[model samples]
Target: MRKLIGCGLVVALAGMLACGVGTEDGPGLQLAFARQPLDAPCPELPGEPGSAPVLDAVELTLLRADGTVHFRKRVSPGSDGKVRVGGIAAGEDLTLEVRGLVSGQVAWYGSAAPVNIRQGVDTTVGIFLAAVGDVSCAARPLQAPRAFLAAAGLPGGRVLLAGGVDRLQADGCGPGCDAWQATAAVDMYDPATGIIYPVARLHTPRALASATLMPDGRVLVVGGVRQLGLQAGSGMFLQVAPGDVLASFEVYLPGPDVWIEKTMPQGMVLHSASLLPDGRVLLAGGGTAPDEEHASNFAYLYDPGLGSAGEVVKVTSAMATRRLGHAAVVTAAGKVLLIGGAIYPTAPPLEEFTPSAEGGVFLEKLSSGLPANLMFAGAAIIPLRPDEVFVAGGRVYDGQVLQPPVTGNSRLIRRISSDDAEWQEGPALASPRWLAGMVTAGRELVLAGGFGDEQLTPSREIEVFDPQGELAAAGQTSVERAGHAAVPLVGGQVLLAGGLGPQDVLRSAELFTPAALAGESEQ
Candidate 1:
């Protein structure tokens, strides 16, 4: 498989961009786009392989803060590229959109957000344009290969990735193999430039933890182990000592780019963390305290804004059942739903959380018409609509020993009203994917990057959850990936960053441009 190249404008040196030609000049700002070798097969430019496109143009559109178009121009580009765009009113909240055109069709996209333009001043910003509906390699590789890392969306169109193990245990270590002394290494991925920047390391290194984006833009990472290992072949646990089982969590501040550790009465692993509408983080169901590797029904609400000390209050009522690897998501109506999850492949009734001024209540929803023993333990539960979530590929064991039970089956969970919700059957994927990265692109869900085999072999196909409850083939990520971080970027592109391949943890990243973002150009 070929690694799709990441093509975009890089803001290095703040000088000449040869691909795009600017039209007019006034009191606006000056910008340039850096170019990369066009490696992908373009039907329009069949003759140009390594040569730059001098005849191709870029459609530039300036947008007001209210999302209204302020200016639109398609400049006939020249080989010596540098565009000087201007002619805008002062104090206008402006944004610039650039679409690289090949044979009069939009092929690449990038954008810049800003606070208007002024005469004799240069506003420097970076923009990244990725090919639509394709997965390509990042311009740069990750610092190292890592798995079980925590990724949270940060301010300024950046993603914070922290605390993951860099090694892969090829020898059989069984259950204890999942936990290892994690690396404190931290990094930031910028969609604007398609670059991964190494940042401040975590004060308390942890793996298998959940990173939540706080309302204030800070990151609150909870649970997971500080150090754990096992003997190869013997399957004996080791490195279990003081601080090995983390009894604390870390908060990462973006401006300072530092990690601060906070003490907790007990730590947890395999926990489900969800941010509520009121700025409180709802942490539910994981192995906690001395035993941080088992399932517990306890839940808590972590308030990051309360005092400087902050506060972690336990929910009075516990979950209906013990869920180790359960999936949890906050509905559009601000309700929390705990879906099927267990240590193994087992299906459980969905649980909903309703908060009052006094406390939050957890009620188990009856599996009235669900498949008998429907398993979504390793599946992805993502937002489909307001108060609705759709479940995608996961480990669905159906007792067929001859055939692997990993399934492509999917279902939609719709919160019909405040008091009731229904499970609607969704279309099955062409390929079965376990632990797939499912993210919403506009109204559609892009299911990409997962292991399709029982041996944890990665997959490369990209599927879409169409709005009409139908499944359609969108495109491919080209690179095999499992357990990677799939995140939506500023523009309409999805970033699939690092995951485990066949034998080792991967350091390669891929960028996916959604079909909806390209409009009619895809057809």
Candidate 2:
């Protein structure tokens, strides 16, 4: 009996030894980092000594599926200019983020594709870092201090910018004291040359307007605030007096470089305009009066084929709710989905507008609303798929002091049928954002700079959201911005232009070439 007991004890000791050995031999990930040869010139600060940026440091972070940081390490490159990070656990899928810094500034930043660790083996991975794309200043617009300006991409890779405040005086007023008058100045941006040339100005000066590209290649510029006479003692430009919303509309012809004045039934501001499948523009829900406090429930349809005079038609049925700063998108089935707006108390319900048999429009309210109360969120339809739409980064008022809370609850909603739709919680953005520029490039959704709750400051971080995967950090702009314009270029790249930047209104613009295409160009 003593020998038997000793044998059991020996076996137990052996089992424990085996477990210890297994842990020591557990799988790990081996990462090797090398800087990719850049085809473009490295970025340099003006009057700086260095001709090209040099790598100073690299930050490595391993994130779990939920975007929580699991392990973080900072390392410098070896003599061979390579970094190796090991000891990652096996069998767990992880996202690897590598940020390269030059003189403490982010020079190159990217994420490695998700990696799967294998037990008992060292998984080897190679990461190549490239220089951040070159950002050269484009020609400034003819008019200075352009704010709340409208821009639309033309068919031939050109962008039309129009109607914003141009400072007229600069005394003891303030930052924008000089610019009190909205200008009708129009400018055309040529991407090939990185220059903007003045074009014909609009008949009426407007600001905070909506510009939509028409089916015939003309651009339709709709309602905005036309400034009344500036108050004598006031240092700032008064956008409008009471009941001073401009009902005038205009169509810009690229061929002639001209703006033809048109008229709308009602003056609107902060309204959303979407192009329908039938080649008509759906203008809906804006502030009827100049003040944002008074929102309109009215909707209008502008028929471009009918020519300039009396082309806008008012929809007989009014919207279920008055919306200001709302978003609208046309679905795959030719229905319009009107999303969250400035309405308060409870989250605004999702409403769909369907075309009726009698050449009218029908409005139906959907039971499934937004995940939360959202306003000024950047929204866009996922490319190639009409049924699914992506909405991200908006402000939600929680009945307290105004805070820019990053809900981290953005989502993707699909229209299963005319009335049936489903919502799935999407990957959270890297940071909370509102009033950002959203556009689709290839299969990825690109969200650019926006205002965040962190100090109420604008974010320069650009996050790319893959519908099938997680949000990956992407290239950033030269300046922090919100209320900017992001227009997808002919290629997969995006043209991002003017908006409110860190200090004041900006006329700067940059081109965001997708990393894949950017890689190809380097090769």
Candidate 3:
């Protein structure tokens, strides 16, 4: 393989000592390459040699942006005898050319798939240099997790992760037991460095509840259980245990890093909440009581400007059925779009709420076209346009288990458009882990670690989906644990913070880079 240097105008091939292509022992290697992003140009261009016989002397050439040969040279393969390109500067997108002579014949020779060289330390493009007959391509690997997380943010900023569950149900125990630790701590990460700093600790515990970041930058942490058990002394060994599925919520101001306890509609677990465009928080459909086997469709709106300021006002009746572990998102039209949660009956109905206090009317009920499973863990919503809500992975709606299984069926990102609507299946995830956290950055959907079955085996894998006309793999993340939180930063990257791992709970975080958009051309 030859490396291209300079502004795509110059190339130098590392010398090979063998005369003919290598023996037929190994298949010829295929070459591939990717241009550097606009902001970060690679200092060098890396090319690949497809599965082919070993060759002797190879020459690399470059076509300058000015249509002139910038430089050409013969390079001795430093270690592997493969040609190397280096010393590229910023602002240069170079087209590389490679040529190799084998068996007294000029065999491997070809140009690259275009390199986007930017101003950066590591800009890699894999170009294959191979003879036609002996060359073959390599298999593609799974997308990286960090690349997915970084693309979840817009150009302006990233998302903010307040605080979430640190451990799965089986923490510090022998095995097969699930529990949640009620801590008042909340943290946010700096997207640039993936560093997490304590934002504030709540006066009380808010675990496994819903959390939303308001437009004003303040975070709202709502209803979660502080204590464990069923019916306050049923003595039943439920996996989760008897706990306070809190009905009350609190506000955490990022600037002040303070927690303000506020009134709530009613205590519930695994409920859904969204911030309406009007600035009021609309919470709906968790469990009315932790001990109850079923959920109440009862919905409420907390008027932050209302009596006592931000009081939870129960206004509506219940939905067609009760739901927990369902998904909800506020549409661009200011309607609360809810869908795909498990009810007590363990059936499927994706519904939405228009937030009417009078008769408790929702836009419509959606139940028809779901992917045969629903989970209550946590779900991320991506708005395709303004009106469409795309619900990604979550727990399968199971009424039998006290805690819905930590696993999720490989369901496509479900879509809920209007109230009187049917659930539509969108692109499915690369993997099917549940309790995973998701956030959006521009055209990419970022998914972070979550549990597979038990929360202890926290998956650190990060998957990003590019929603540009077609959904595709953007990149992968470095972490492998689950039950963590991911938020977009003010910059282009996203910050991922604490979650559960197999050995112990995590307090660390990482950053994701969405280089796909940054590297590709606009048109």
* TM-score for candidate 1: 0.83
Query: Compared with the true structure, what per-residue lDDT tens digits does model 3 show for residues 497-516?
Result: 55544454554444454543
Task: Give the number of colliding residue pairs in candidate 3.
Answer: 87
Locate the minimum summed-lDDT window of 10 residues in model 1: 41-50
Pairs of residues at least 3 apart in sequence or in different chains that clash in candidate 1 = 4-136, 4-137, 18-81
What TM-score do all the candidates reach, one by one?
A: 0.83, 0.67, 0.60
Candidate 3 local Cα displacement, residue 474, angstroms: 4.5
CA RMSD per model (angstroms):
5.8, 17.2, 13.8
Tens digits of per-residue lDDT for model 2 on 1-523?
1110000000000121223332334432233332222222112111112122345666666667776776666666546454444444553667555556667665554444355555544344333233444332332333344656788888655778888765445532344323345678887766433446778999999877899998788999998876533222211123354466788898998997888897777898878898888888888887732223566788898887675532888888777777766677877778788876645535344677776533456455554644554566777777766677787887653433223547574877777344666666777888787777887765777888876653436678788776564677786676777656677654345656666566666665555655643321110
Report lDDT per candidate. 0.63, 0.61, 0.47
- TM-score attained by model 2: 0.67
Q: List candidate 1 segments past 4 Å from native.
A: 1-6, 10-31, 35-55, 62-67, 90-95, 112-121, 172-180, 227-245, 288-293, 342-348, 357-359, 371-384, 397-405, 416-418, 520-523
Comparison by TM-score, 2 against 3, better one: 2
**What is the lDDT for 130 in model 1?**
64
Of candidates 3 and 2, the better by lDDT: 2
Best-performing candidate as measured by TM-score: 1
Task: Show where candidate 2 strays beyond 4 Å.
Answer: 1-143, 168-180, 227-242, 288-293, 308-310, 356-359, 397-403, 407-409, 416-418, 454-456, 519-523
